[model samples]
Target: MRSPVEPKSAGAWRSQIPTGKALVPYLLLAPFGCLFAVFIVAPLVYAFYISLFRDTLVGGRQFAGAANYLRVMSDDKFWAGLGNLFLFGIVQVPVMLGLATLLALVLDRGQLYGEALFRLGLFLPYAVPGVIAALIWGYVYGPVFGPFAQLAEAIDVPAPELLSREAMLFSIANIVTWEFLGYYMIIFYAALKAIPPHLLEAALLDGASRWQFVRYIQLPLLRPMILLAIVFSINGTLQLFNEPYLMRVHAPTVIDSSYTPNLYAYSLTTANQQYNYAAAISFVLGAVIACASYLFILVSGRRRRR
Candidate 1:
């Protein structure tokens, strides 16, 4: 049993501590909290406020309540932008994640020569800025001066019309896939490395084939990271902007003001100065992303339970 003096001493020590000292940890975090409140929280709140109004040159400005959201629901251009995102996400995400997983698996196997150098090389492309990657790939896809065109000319074949409407979305997808593949690869690779080696060794001892081990062991362990990648990809695809924005110059006809929801909102805010409507569009996009994230979490939870 503890002595009464010890308990009293502990209580006295705690009581002796200054009340202000209790706030030291929060005080340390104050700068970041202030910045986040000012930048992130303030903007979101302001945007929501703006979204509740109607802005027009003739009508000036008026409180519209949910009118902007109603307008967005019936907006054809808005749905078209969403359709583009849905198509892009549906096709591009799986391909990029699949390639990333394959590379991570290969690197994790430890059989490849110069594994560190190979891994570094695989990840280096992700270091390139999105704008720069778009420009580089745009140049490569250019119908006239691009090497691909020259190669086609030399072979007496037609240069691929990569900037055409039929292929523009896919061309943009290629750029996106190229830009992010290394990022997801590095993520999956880290997850793979974090997996305990003892489990793998036991599987090997049990005469598990490579496919059997990966299918039964690695895939299960990888589910969490895979879900994370899916969520990130979902957000990225729905908010697609940079690649398409940059590609607009090279493929102006195909890439227009309403190319993606972000671009559409941007055009409305800047070009048409429809700030309220643009805010509504932005909020809608955010809501869609939130719902998508929720569904993914729900499905993942169900799958894990099973």
Candidate 2:
């Protein structure tokens, strides 16, 4: 039959196709979008709003305009804290990422025995809560009663104090690296695994040595993941608090109240009773992190284009 024309059938097929296509993208994005709005966007907006006001104990609240921001700009402690973070970022980031990349490569080698156990051991520290990690490491760094000191004493050598002002920054960085190295290693490993096996096989057939393969094949493939890991590490370093905070409680002189931006913000809110100032500092810190992340992404993208 010229058929009354299968209009309903054709329409149903057309509708189903579009619906299936639309559903996939939406379903993929739904969870992340919800979380982004709730945790990131909403809190950011609220923090920005809080930064614009002057909180008071007795008087009514009033808009401070940009006074809080200006105060933060002029505050030496804020600048110093940010500078410390910058210093940490410069020294710690490359070391951590390099180690992570190396570990990932080692683990990705099929010849490694007990690869799963090694990977688990490496990443296990990340599962520990940050506070607990900090506390455990804090005791380990204590010279008077910690393991290092005991070992040094047994060996008849002077115990190196990790909490000294001269070594505090490095000490904290070490703790951080120890805690997060495996986590980033896993990320790089995953990225490495995603590369096609045939590509490496071809490189090997072409007489490429291990270092050559790493430099030309593996590293190039890992560029995106490395950049992502760098961005995350920068953000974490900038917001460092728990390690220094716990360390400070153990050795007060080693880590000052304003050891990092987050610690400074905490001090402002709790010790100084300056919630408004704390909020303003937080907003500025957030802005700095956002800008730094954007710049890293931009530079990485440009390099990739080249």
Candidate 3:
């Protein structure tokens, strides 16, 4: 039989320990909290405040209420940038996710040879900085000097102009695919690793083929990770800027200042000096991203429940 005094002694010890348990958490969180306040929260508040006014270089600032938001509704460039993002989300996200899942499955199979090497090779590109990746790919797409063009000319085959306006978006998508596929593959691979070994053994005992196991068991279990990857990809596509910006510098005629929402906002602030309009656009973009993220969560939750 347990002594009655044992429980009370344990409770007394717990009570004797400093009441500063919460202090540890606050101390650990202080740096990130301060950074969030300075970088994210402050900027967000400033953007909101700026959005409510119209800045004048010559005259004084004037309160515009929701006029800036209303202006966004009619902005042709804003719609175009959104349309471009929509196209990218539709095309790029599925392809990248699919490829990542396939690679993860292949690598997860124990019988595969050189799995580590293959995994490392696939993930290596993601380690390269985005700006550097863009620059390298941009040079590869260069007409007179790029390796592709040189190869095509060597074989007396016509090289398509990859930097043409019609092909530039696809060109950018290709770069993103190359850079991120490996990184996302690692994510899917980790998810695959988390599945209980007993679950796989049960499926095998039930006479499930590899295809059946993957289709019914593996994919269903991976749904949450897939949903997360899709959300990340959508956000990334909407925030596309660096690749196009670098490509524009390399191939001046291809990407314009209004190539994407970020670039458009940058031009408004830097070139046009319309900081208020830029702030408004920034808020609208953030709101769009938030709404999309919420819709993704809601839809995914419904599917999960079903």
Candidate 4:
């Protein structure tokens, strides 16, 4: 007598196994995906929805379509703000990154005394919140009673007014540079440390000087990190919020409501209560960040491939 065959559908077994395996990853990722949808995607969709309308005082909000976008395109203040940001980026980013790289190199060489203390001290400023750093620098930049002014007086020289309209952007840049130097330095120092010791030994055995070694070996190896830093720095320069916002209290005339794009959006949203237009500005700024970041990553990827 042939026993009834137990159910053994191969397709059923295969389907169940693969489906379960596939679902495990999604299950693990569910929390983050849900959070992103709730926080990031929902807000973006809401902002875009608001950006399509115009708030009216007499009437209820009216649909404006792309009118706000058109207004943004022609906005002189927007362009001026962008010009100021570009100037700040052009002048500050290279200087800050260069100084960070130099410090990282010096630290990586292991020649300096109190290297640990130096690293801690260098990184200390970054631990100070951006708002606090801005406030601290604002006090120091005070024309009469700030520490810098007092020092100048003690030395019998007039103090440079840092928050003057002519110098306000640069003063903000300085504060930003001070805050971020250690962060970039640590990034570069980590990259430097990752270089194989054998390569350094080979360079040394070939009678390469320290400068030559850094130029020929370290710099080439650091192209990726350099590109990374540039992308981050550019994104940061575009945002340009905390320092300017905090310092605006000290120099209201120099730092206006629209000192930068973020500040512009804040002014529109908080001061003018033009929620729709502020959303439009924020949306445009997001587009700019995405485009710029994509371009940088694309170029860097191409260079690496080459």
Give the per-residue lDDT of model 1 (tens digit) for 94-174.
999999999999999989889989889888878999889999999999998999999999999999998889898899999
What's the distance in Å from true for residue 225, model 4? 0.3
Best lDDT goes to which candidate?
1
Q: Model 4, 174-240: lDDT tens per residue?
A: 9999999999999899999999999999999999998999999999898789888999999999999
lDDT of 1: 0.91
**lDDT by candidate, in order shown:** 0.91, 0.89, 0.89, 0.91
Error of 3 at 32 (Å): 3.3
Question: Per-residue error at 102 for model 1, in Å?
Answer: 0.5
Kindly indicate the candidate among 1 and 3 with the higher TM-score: 1
The TM-score obtained by model 1 is: 0.92
lDDT of 3 by residue, 1-306 (tens): 125454456556555544577569778899999999999999999989989999776878999999999999899999898988888779889999999999999888767888889999999999999999999999999898999999999999998789988888789999999999999999999999999999889999999998999999999888888989999898888899889889988667656777789999999999998988899999899889989988988998897788
> TM-score of predicted model 3?
0.89
Per-residue C-alpha lDDT of model 2 across residues 1-306, encoded as one tens digit per residue: 226655566556554554667789888999999999999999888878888899777876889999999999999999899998898889999999999999999998867889889999999999999889989988898887899999999999999988898888898899899899999999999999999999889999999998898899899889878988999998898899988899998788767888898999999889998878898999889889999998998898898789
From the highest TM-score down, the ranking of the candidates is 1, 4, 3, 2
Q: RMSD, model 4, all Cα superposed?
A: 8.3
- Candidate 4 lDDT trough over 10 residues, lowest sum: 12-21
> Which regions of candidate 3 deviate over 4 angstroms?
1-28
TM, every model: 0.92, 0.84, 0.89, 0.89
